[model samples]
Target: MSLSVTKKRSLAALAAACLASVALPATPALAQKVKNKTPAAEASASSVDYVVTIPSVEAVQSSMDEATITDILSGNLAGNAAALAELDATSITIPEITVTLDVEVDGETERGTLTLSNLVLEDVSDGVATSMRLNGSSFATPEGNADMGTISAENVNLAAILGIYGLVDAGASREMQTLYTDFLVGGGSFSSDEFSCDIGAISGGEVRGRPFETSFVEIISIAQSMEDNPEDISPELLGKFVRMYADLLTAFESSEFTFDGLDCAGTTDEGEALAISVAGITMAGMSPGIYPQLSFDGLSIVADDGTMALENFTLKQFDLSSVIATLEAAPELVEESWFEANGRGLIPAFEGFSFSGLSMDIEDQDNEGERIIADVAEFDLSLGQYLNGIPSALDTWARGLRVDLPEDSEDEQVQQLLALGITTIDAGFRIAAAWNADTNTIDVEEVSMSGVDLASVALKGTIANATEALFSLDMDEAMTAGMGMAVKALSVDVVDSGLSDIVLAVVSAEQKVDPKTLRPVFAGLAEGTVVGMMAGVADAAKLGSALSSFIAGKAKSLNISVEAKDDPGLSLEDFMMAEDDPTTLLGKVNIDASAK
Candidate 1:
């Protein structure tokens, strides 16, 4: 049996418990009710336990003649809400207890034990208990065992859990209902024959589950009882389950949770030791339109021959307000025809996501000693002001992306590149844009890629007459939209910090000459070529002068821009046709050029 299953069965057994004849401690408020008297001392004539004979709920039935309870009924399964309402005590406490379950594993039955210390159910009001707690908890099975420091829950919906809602005013139903305000689990550990884990504290708050009015446990019981053909489910059954999904954002509107740390160690199939560790994960501020911010600072995977590590990761501003709103407007979308009507439209608004300091190192002995390694400083994407599930503004970038090339390479190109002190393409890249739906225009703010000690070239432009038809699937419609767009403004800017000088050096090295001697020689050749190519242009000499100065290393930057004279400036189709004729294209627009 899995550790999770053992935990559930063991806890369920204690939930349907053993009554001890002893006085138990209570809070200051309930202290008056528990004045050194036994738990049943105040038990009215209405007190009764009806769910006396369920399988996992029966603790001592497997090894002994009966459970730890004082009495046993032969054939009842669960109690009704009416029976639950008869309880009059402010609290119910049980001594340290142990429950054994007959676990099924590999078609055979084995033993699992769940031990809980000093369990308490307090602040009974209506048909619910306001809180529940246990000092310590542990679950043990043949496969593995887990021990926890403490377990507790506050504002627990006891009525729903005890099957009170299974039968409602109308009669029996299947709508599942569960709600709780806060839940906490202290440090814990799990160990098996080949693997072991150490888990830190966990916490949850403002948790809302399925909004259905039915009982949660009964739904599980029905699902478990189904033998075969479970996939051949009815639409009504599917709809009921789907409606239960709509309440998630509405449930965790103000919920927050955290995981402190987890460290697990095991072995690979070849018996090589491997371990995984994660720490400092927190999530907060989850609501309909706002996604919870989740972040972690430490994570790593280590093996005998390799390791992977990350400094931090964070994701936030994933908004599902539109999806939730769409469902509320047409709850029928969750029914049998979900895919056609609703599933395709479930795009969440992405606001931001990022990670930092990622590194990987792997040495594979099976692949002739080949190694795979990488280091990335940061990567991020951010967007805002969504329209029709599209972000109106977006910015994304990747910085310091790097990977090494082997020194002993088979390819001649690799050897030549390495001979020039070039290894990996350690570079950064960025692209940013904004769309104005009201104006039918898009502004590409910036697009650039830059390498270490290399050149940076950026392009920015504005396009007008961009319409919703551009988002269509039909090729003809999209093509028509593209043809209709006009260039409002465009510019290219280049910053050659060292790329030009390095290229000159490479050429000089091949020719056995000094790079300083080639600068002016190459510059004059470039200028003469440019003027010859544009002999008939009005600004040929001026453009040639700037190009020559830039190549001679006398100028480190070059810029060029094209701007429309008026509205409906230059259509892309017209620009493409006239692109080969510089004189005609220049006559249609204003050109700006400079070098510095």
Candidate 2:
């Protein structure tokens, strides 16, 4: 089984499940209702294999985004602003839209191709099974360092998979419908069954950071269900589900979501070695009742040297219970919220919903100035777990969320880089929330690195310059319980230092450098402008310049006392409560870096 095939099945089932969950009127009943008016009947339905070709996939995507997706049942805009925006943004420009499905629910398979030039409302509103096939796609930049070229898929199937439209009025139908199809690719010879294997490379676009050589095989399967299956389903529910599925498909087809370099060495028009690859894969899907799990295996991205860049690059496991939960709960939540907010209204008032628990790993190497920089980065993530709840209500009030973090609990690759002279190494930044509504907030706890080798660097003009200074900070919490609303509290402390060449040369061997660990110790001793100017970006020169001014102002009154006894340090309990509800604790924090 291939990851692509698995995704196909996973997505197909997902689409089916999503569609089935949204209740809709019987297809025949709705069709008859709109047939009374002759012009409406002709305009509202058609049985042509709908095919639309764009100059490029982007054009198709652009069109999807810009066009208003009317409610096929009601012919109204559906009052779904987000839906409108999403569809408007994903218009794709495909080379051709071919409908080649001939089914009779009997024992015979008939087939023919339907060419679609212009995609209008009538075709979709007719409830026809339209399959779309993508042949080629291209993306380029002027200088082209970041250019991706040539994406082609032959005889692609896109019937209900793409979605059908009905044209009546806004309040006519409260649901949408979809048909499902699965595409399979093989090399030896086309299979008699819809899904059978062939020996050949997958034919598609060339993505960077992926290996697509060795005659690897490719397959694409699709299946769909209507949005009118659940009992008492409404338009609001239908719209939300369709929008979610559409967004998922759009993401899978997007630059950010697609893996790069299937043939890792493919060249651009201007010619630069492609940096990634993931091809020669197979895909499939299966449903087992309550929840569906799609697994991928035998997936690899090989480099020019025959080395597998993604040796273990496979969907080893996937547990979508939370995702399933969200899908099931969203409609109910939307309906309840809408009615509560607007008095039994059917308008889709989309609150927010998200699925968390996702984990994956990738192993690869890239040519850094001189080294291959070989290693693996992995992560295990749970949305509602790691981030119990952020410090803001806005974070929780979102429509969707996704997160990608460093998979390796111990990011050895980064540590290896830091060990080398890569002082500015890119650390694995943890990704938690991917909220789609309003303000989105991400968190970065701290960076880890070894600091021993950097003890001798010197600043040309500052005070007795210091050398190696390795520091790490521990945060208590970014969010916590307050008097009422969610509250946020953060604490940062710095430690660790080694002498620079200048400082080492000036101090006597008998004088230990540890005592001078505090940079503020020297700054505190200063008298004038220095103390007042310490709240911004600081450099040795700036500190030096401000010292004299700081010494002049508070030198006499400066207090420098340290208590040897430990008494729980200092308490700012008075300031904690005010973090969220300012009326209670007062939004203030006491500064106490000193331990005595």
Candidate 3:
């Protein structure tokens, strides 16, 4: 039985999105806000609790487990390891799916585990058709449990052509492979170190108009204690963990599933830990088609760290718009090299859908070893090219038909803009800190970048003692302070090799000081000598003047000058930072220090 064309196309789209990803930074797992509710008051709230709704859960689940379809295309049995085209019992009994959660909670400690069981899958296709179902499911937690969730399915499949898992050859198997690949390309996977559940179910209308089907059921841990201590959640480790899970989830959502409904619930031993529950959901493809519309009623997460447990926790909607916008913003993120390495037989549409919006919290230990709790948000994702009209035969024949060109027309222009944007970024994050008792005062010593002010850019010069050099100026405090703190007295000496001649020069300035005072502030200054010390103040002043003259002579030997009224312009040392002279764009400018 040959699958229809629509099913095949749907499957291809799913596969493309999955396999072509490259350099996808892990998404940190954290709750996002729902639109309708007021920002949950932070007064008693110590953690975020969020609820999410999903639609077309069954359709999406089918696509998530497309690996079964891939097995069919690659000439293998379903879950039992039977040969492709061979008949296992048409119907195999699948156990009911159950999720068990175990948790331990103290005043400030939380730990838990979730177990899933009884997941059944059916073999509905021999390269011609595919289908599956989800039995009744329930959840059990240490605190309590629920039985209000159900998993269902509908008609689904990818393009007809199938052969190898990623290779598209022409034949019955090839057709099956193509369809399977398509579904996987568009659909994604739900995987975890503790558990994994994926079903690739491609859905489309049949000749007789029968619908496609697929579904999923699984368990997730509510919370856990860090290896070091309950209060010490390693931010670094937590960040990495959240990012991995988020990336995997994103890959699944982009696949063939159009979510309809999803419900999840869990609780902890201590009421202050957190309680999360979600149900009623919907989702749909970007464009209109038979693809299911996914929606969820309510999804929520509550965090109680002996502080305040977040109430009315909700993740109303997944920001698909933001996902799409990110793709549009950075296409190179999904390169052909990445698609080739990971995508193999996937389509181009899935090439560059960037994965983002992962967040987590960890215990930050200070130098003194006191713990400072902080939440870190991480964005790790990638994007790639989109396939349009198939290229010419010659292009395909020269190598494989895989297209490596940029998806957008203005790729070069966009890259240039990105480069320019970061040029001044480093000059932004410098600070000077002073500690007084329990309080610390940090002054902005330089520039600030990223708004949060985490790092500082030091304008260091690596001059090779060149007679003349130029550089760019970043409008920051380091540049300003260095100029303001110039000495009030100096010396100069210039030696000209030509004619074997030498010229000596001196310069001085007085700092204003009041005469009438209990302790007179010294008015004149010299290098390595001070005046106005009690009875011998006259002799000290004379000695200070002689020292000042000598110092002035030495300072005058070197010529340094500041350009007047130069607003954010390039400086002399700027050229030293570059491989080529910046002045090449404007020609040469001379410097004179003869004191005339």
Candidate 4:
């Protein structure tokens, strides 16, 4: 049935009842019929009913005073007393409101359908406002979840949120007053399921605020203002505010957050305008620790008319439960004691980290220079249980780590280095180490690098008393407790003919220097001269010349070894601070050199 026809019939029935009351007088037959129909049966007969109204701001405000409105908007009255009280105390106005509800009854079931054509909240003292509209909203029976359809909102200012919580301050700047979210359109359904509620993707929307140097500073400033006033604020609530500020600071200080698949722009406090848009952003397993597992996918940044981007970046596996727990317990903390207790309490625990497919291309518009591009294929760092009072190990490796040099390089130093057999350099390094608490030692199982080797080289060593020296924080004692401190072997195998010739050329050039001519200059110095007294140069020169000739003529592949003699362990302090001849410090150690 048409709504207009239903409305006409209702009005006609009311006119008939009025005429009967005046002319026919009250009849027992009419009263019997009215009493015969039950309220539910009567409502059922009417089936679908529609009500349309344009409610004024004052009317809306008065309606919010109703218990049902108050309960629905501000949870339960008992637990949300503060919110209810705030609602009653604050002055709110709606410039325009149009609501349409189509309520229907079938058997014992009742359903409500709502469509909002326009909604505007204005006349706020803080100059904040909002406008929203919804189409085809449906309510489930028995006060169940509402299913929203194509909802849109505009001019959702931050001040409105603050004002709702009674946090609006008149002294705040316009920037703080004017910061707002742009138009957003989304739809979602609320149901009785864990994490099932989903707000559909936003096609396009942005939240903007006054360009402050940092969000941390701005939030802290607002918190400080509230602290100074202390009106209507409980100590516990204040502590919570401080705690949130501290968490924000800690997160910003510790982690690198990457954003992708977002359209963003902002102005810095220094008045520099910046803008960036990306395909998407992924920050995986971020935590407040020294080693946080994080990742970014398809990231891009636009700056100074140029772009820097990465395909994927990741840091793997670390626990941040301690940090989160500390932050969550802020409300129970004593006021004015938060900073003192947590300022230096950060301890990081991490498992692994990695990076891959990073690239950058930058252009200097001001200088009209060529675009500079650089790329990296992969980089990774991994750790196994360190510093948690557990046995720990570490492994790191990298591949295809290179930089693209400009065809016409601008820097003279870079060009010079490239000229000397260094072009489009590729390099990689690998390190593996383990800590043994039982033996109090750190065993470096392997340390190797490529692209800087005349021959394949590997270094293996152990730091004796590693646990005590590192964890005990007593350098002097650790230096004097050296034990079993000797290199087991030192060897190198020439793998490239060109690198072998370079080594031979360097040694032969050194041998060609006239040792006799170099000896006289040191020999002519007096016994008390600065050079003679400082280094014993006259006696060292003769020994150095003989050793140089021996190395140049006999050394094909070099090896060296040192064993602790039958004496006390070497004292690092004595070796560094000794004022006597340098060789005197080596008297307590044995040395061997060989060439084969």
Estimate every model's Cα lDDT from 0 to 1. Answer: 0.63, 0.27, 0.26, 0.43
Which of the two candidates, 1 or 4, achieves a greater TM-score against the reference?
1
Candidate 4 accuracy as TM-score: 0.44
TM-score of each: 0.75, 0.28, 0.24, 0.44
Residue-level lDDT of model 4, residues 125-233, one tens digit each, is 2233344333324443344454544443455443333432223332333232222333333444555322123334233233333322223224444444463345555
Q: Candidate 4: which stretches are off by over 4 Å?
A: 1-71, 74-260, 263-292, 302-305, 321-344, 350-352, 363-372, 383-396, 405-416, 431-434, 452-458, 472-571, 574-596
Query: What local lDDT does model 4 show for residue 347?
Result: 35
Comparing 1 with 2 on TM-score, the higher-scoring candidate is 1
Please identify which of the two predictions, 2 or 3, would achieve the higher lDDT against the true structure.
Answer: 2
Model 4: weakest 10-residue lDDT segment is 24-33
**Which RMSD values do the candidates have, in order?**
10.5, 21.1, 23.9, 21.2
Descending-lDDT candidate ranking: 1, 4, 2, 3
Look at candidate 1 and give me any clashing residue pairs: 175-214
Model 1 deviation from native, Cα RMSD in Å: 10.5
Clash counts for all predictions: 1, 90, 141, 4
Best by lDDT: 1
lDDT of 2 by residue, 202-259 (tens): 3333111111111011111111122123445555545455335422321221011222
